[model samples]
Target chain A: MIQVENLTKKFGNVAAVDGVSFNVENREIVGFLGPNGAGKTTTMRVLTSYLAPTSGRAAVAGFDVVRNSLEARKRIGYLPESVPFYPEMRVREYLSFRAKLKAVPRKQRKQRLDEVMERCRVKDVEHKIIGHLSKGYRQRLGLAEAIIHNPPILILDEPTIGLDPAQIRQTRELIKELGQDKTVILSTHILPEVEMLCNRVIIIHQGKIAIMDTLNNLVKDQKIKLEITGNINDITETLKQLPGIKNISFTQQDLWYVVTIELSNNEDIRDIVYQKIVQNQWGIREFKTERTTLEEMFIRITTRE
Target chain B: MRNIWVLTKKELAIYFYSPLAYVIITAFLLLSGYFFYQFVAGIADATALRYVLEFIGFISLIISPMITMRLLAEEKKSGTLELLMTAPITETQVVVSKYISSLLFFIALIMPTVAYVILLIFWGKPDLGAIICGYLGLICLAGVFLSIGLFVSSFTSNQIVAVIITFVILLIGWVIGWAGEFFREQWWKDIFKYIGFFEHFDAFRKGLIDSRDFLYCFSLIIFFLFLTVRIVESRRWK
Candidate 1:
């Protein structure tokens, strides 16, 4: 339920979120993948109504981010990068304060607070001062505050940034559960977190949307690695003759041939390669096809600088 | 209005839970009380409560900065301003809530000084109207100083910087009248004296409820608060 139209944010001469646009459907989890200073946080801030766009428009839950920021904010929960909190407040008190700030009705604030506390799995530390809690608990508390009002849309900037392995897994599970019912836009540097939690991925680099699509399509489109052993010279020629081959290269050893190919469409080429090897009567020691992971894809897109 | 109340309540809770509030109030009371006691001892008359009120006006200069230095600066330093700004609340509500809550704490700290009023009642029979008017003036004075402090705090994340800037602004506002001495023109001297905070305090101490003086305090409060709102809103654009 979020639509961003040519959103751009400029801090002086720097365009933090350069002309970017995307849409998120109801109950869909969209992962924002980018490297440091890639404008991920800037875009999140624009969507959450925390910062005004230097140009263009955005709407959350059908409310314009500029003209109707208060209404837009009411329908979304945002956990900023780093999750800063009042250190002296107890966990429960802090959530209660955030509940009121979010305008959760007075009659339902306490119940809402309790529900979020449970949802974030922070019920046990309700009374402990937030400053005394560990980093994981603090992150959970930040999440709890974001959802305390039960907004339909969640914009989390790095929800699992500094957590340990266990905490990351727990947070991933919690985000998965959240995505089942609410529209979530998660911005993070961790590729696997995006892979496991998001159905769609939007990769941004240098303040532009480099790629945005379903994970399956992204992998199927860009992932191609060929390992084949045959008459090296003739095999290279045959592979280059293939219709959809993008690039061909071999290691210096020259004993094995590695060809990098980008398919024009989703087509199976394994059978064709097998037939070519048989015709040549060359021993095929290894023949495998592997797709690129999100990590590799991210590196490829961001490192193109 | 509801959001303002919620924020005010949260701010008040913070004031009580943190040591800063207690320390400021205790120090204020002890210092004001000592001065009040000494004034009575030297004058050997309880009627000198007016002098005590005048002196506490100066005490407000110090305590106002202490109460307000952390209002917005601490939020920026800790990054909680992002949370508050992202919530469904307007900038005016945030500024007003913070201003009122700090003023309330200042009032509460000064409330204990009512015992001093009772002391005057039993000993020297101070003018009840003048005493009441003086307390009203002190509250308004605190309101003006707190607004200045809040506005200054919004400019920087460093609490020390906020406090130092606030003190300097308050000192300028306090001493603008003296600068009139250098000018030979009556109009310039009159202008400086009119802008002085102490000039307004003098009207309240005389037990006269002038709307002009009330407007002066109200306009100063609104002006600084509006400046605070602009500063906060400008950050989002940046």
Candidate 2:
């Protein structure tokens, strides 16, 4: 339940987020994919009411971010890029304080603190001072602080940045669990994370939204890569006659020729292709379908003018 | 109001949990105690804290910046300002809570000096009216200096720079009254005398409850606190 229209935030002469527009529906896990300095964090800060947009409007839960900032901020749980914390405070003490600041009911404050600590996996370090916490623990603590109030909207900027691989997977699972009920907008440069976690992806480049679509639609072009030993002309002629084949290209890999066949639709034509290969008595080594990856699409979108 | 209290409690906890508050408070008490003993020994039978309170005011003028330097600056440097400002709290709440916590710690710093007042009462017939006024004057002076320090701290992320610049500003506010003596024009003299922070404390120090001095002290506090709030609010625009 967030709406942003023509949002542009300028820091002096340079615009960090220029003419960016996007909306996120309730319970939709949307990933913001962009390289560094691509206005992902700036967009998030504006939504969280941390930075006032220079021009245009953003509303959260039906409240304007600037005019009704308190109400708007009340619905948002933001985890900033760096995950800042007061180092002297013990982890449990800090979460309680954050819960109070977020206006969690006093009766539920303790329970909420424990719940977030467990969900974020910072319970083991709850008694230790934050300054002494490892980076992964501190990052999780930041996540705990964010959801302490159990806000309906979450704006996480690189929530998995500093975590180890196992921690990253855990955080992804946590975000996925949170996303089942909350509207989540997470930004990251990691393409695979978005592919695994997000239903919708928004790619921003140079302070502008390059593309926004469902993950499936963005990577819809599928191709079959086949490694076979046969007469190159005969293999190409046989693949061209297939019903769903859109295009074919070949590359030589030593003695074997690698054939890339683009498909016209989302269909399994491997059985027919196998039959034709068997009838021709050609030796096939590799035959697998490959969807156009978000990584390749992300590079293409961000690197283009 | 609830948000203000929550933030104020957090701010107070930060002060006590760290060694900075203890070190500064102990140093202030030692310096004030040494000065009080010297003043009493020199006078043979000192009955009034007139000079002692004045010296203590000067010491607070120098010590106050240390208390407030990290209030806003450290938040900015450590990027915690993002967390603080994004919370569902107003700028007034944040600024008021920071001002109140530092004011409370400052009060704690001066509370032990009440023992000096008690000792005076025990040994000799001290002018209770002048001593009360002197202590009130110290509190009001602190309100002025601490507010200014909070205002200065809002401008920089560097704590050392915050302290130095705040010290310079408070020193100027303290000594600006001397400029009045150099001016031949009556208007120039009156302007300096009215604006000088120390000049307002003189009436309270002499046991006279002048409403003009009270108004001046309050107006300065309100002005600086208002400025600090505006500075915090301006952050979002940038």
DockQ, computed on Cα atoms, for candidate 2: 0.89
TM-score of chain B of 2: 0.96
Which parts of model 1 have CA positions greater than 4 angstroms off?
A221-264, A267-287
Q: What is the per-residue lDDT of model 2 for residues A1-305, given as tens digits with 9 covering 90 to 100?
A: 99999999999999999999889999999999898999999999999998999999999989999999999999999999999999999999999888888999999988888889999999999999999999999999999999999999999999999889999999999999999999999998788999999999999998999999999888888999999998999999998999888999999988799999999887788899999999999999999989999999998987877
- Candidate 2 clashing pairs, residues 3+ apart or interchain: none
Displacement of residue B94 (Cα, Å) in model 1 is 0.3
Candidate 1 DockQ category?
Answer: medium
> Could you give candidate 1's per-residue lDDT for residues B40-107 as a string of tens digits?
88886645877888889988998798899999999999999999999999989999999999999989
Docking class of 2: high
For model 1, residues A208-276, the per-residue Cα lDDT tens digits are 999999998887754245565666777688877866766666653366556555665567876886787
After superposition of all CA atoms, the RMSD between model 2 and the true structure is: 1.5
- What local lDDT does model 2 show for residue A167? 97
Provide per-model DockQ scores.
0.80, 0.89
